[model samples]
Target: MKKNKKNFETKFWAGFEAGNPFEASDALFDFAHLDYYKRNLTQAVIYSFKEEICSNNTPSEIFIFYKAIGSFLKIYYSLHKKSSKWKVKEPVRTEDVFHLTSLTKEEYDNPFTVFQKAFAETAFKDFEFFLAEIINLSLSPCKEDWNIDLMSPYIHLIKMLDAGELMRERGLEKIKK
Candidate 1:
């Protein structure tokens, strides 16, 4: 059982690295179904996001990664609220994983800055919706209702926007050449 669980987790990370959202999402759904202590689940989410941001990926890939993170968070938060058995006194904050410093005007024009802006604008909205849905779904009698897929039309919109941003960046580079 343990070996199978490890293999399942390996599939998730492998899919994540390859930017395959469907594979990662399916693996994550299976992994989340396994019995987990609250601390371990929270740690999984924190570490997953930390690793994602640290790695170099395209903007659309990052969007997909964020969706996966948001999906995981939905499960984590639902479990946390629905159970009174465990309490996390000091939950891992996002700032702890994502180190953000002030940037100059010149720095603001960079690709990273564009990603930061998109994250603030789009990803944050997705997280907010997921959180709201989680809260609403918690009252349901069915556990299956707790599983919320983050992939939607909104995600496609963000992907299209990211692609447009990438094209604009490439155009700027070509002009500079």
Candidate 2:
């Protein structure tokens, strides 16, 4: 099993290096043993790679990196779900995070649906908005309930994004020096 896993990883990288993203993605999905939820996540990565990485006409190396990441996220989410052991924890309500004075129907519904179509549809043009919506879904003030355990992956995503944003800002500041 370990050897098979290693070979799967090697084949994936080899396909990616050979400038065959479709092959790489197929190898990943086959070796991944993905469930319904994870398959959707994989679809998102593929869509992002095709739309953002390919249409932008990035270098092969950059494209491969993003491709790998999409696969990685799918794997990570699957493993994370498994490790959770299906423990039942009380969900933290939205009121615990924010005191909303009022909200329109759209405002109330948006948070719940932000991610519903993210993987299913490729219509979301604003990548930043899509990313922000993902993070916001993890954070409250926009939801009626939260499950810290189930939402762990999203919370970690937000932390990584925040750290990346800080590094980007600092890099820009240094560039101006």
- Tell me, by lDDT, which candidate is best: 1
Clashing pairs in 1: none
Report each candidate's C-alpha RMSD, comma-separated, in the order given.
Answer: 19.2, 18.2
Off by over 4 Å in 1: 1-57, 88-126, 130-177
TM-score, candidate 1, is 0.22
- Report lDDT per candidate: 0.35, 0.32
Q: What tens digits encode model 1's per-residue C-alpha lDDT throughout 75-156?
A: 3333223223322222233233221122333332333333334355555557557434433333233334225454442343
Return model 2's CA RMSD, one decimal: 18.2
TM-score of each: 0.22, 0.24
Kindly give the stretch of ten consecutive residues in candidate 1 with the minimal lDDT sum. 168-177
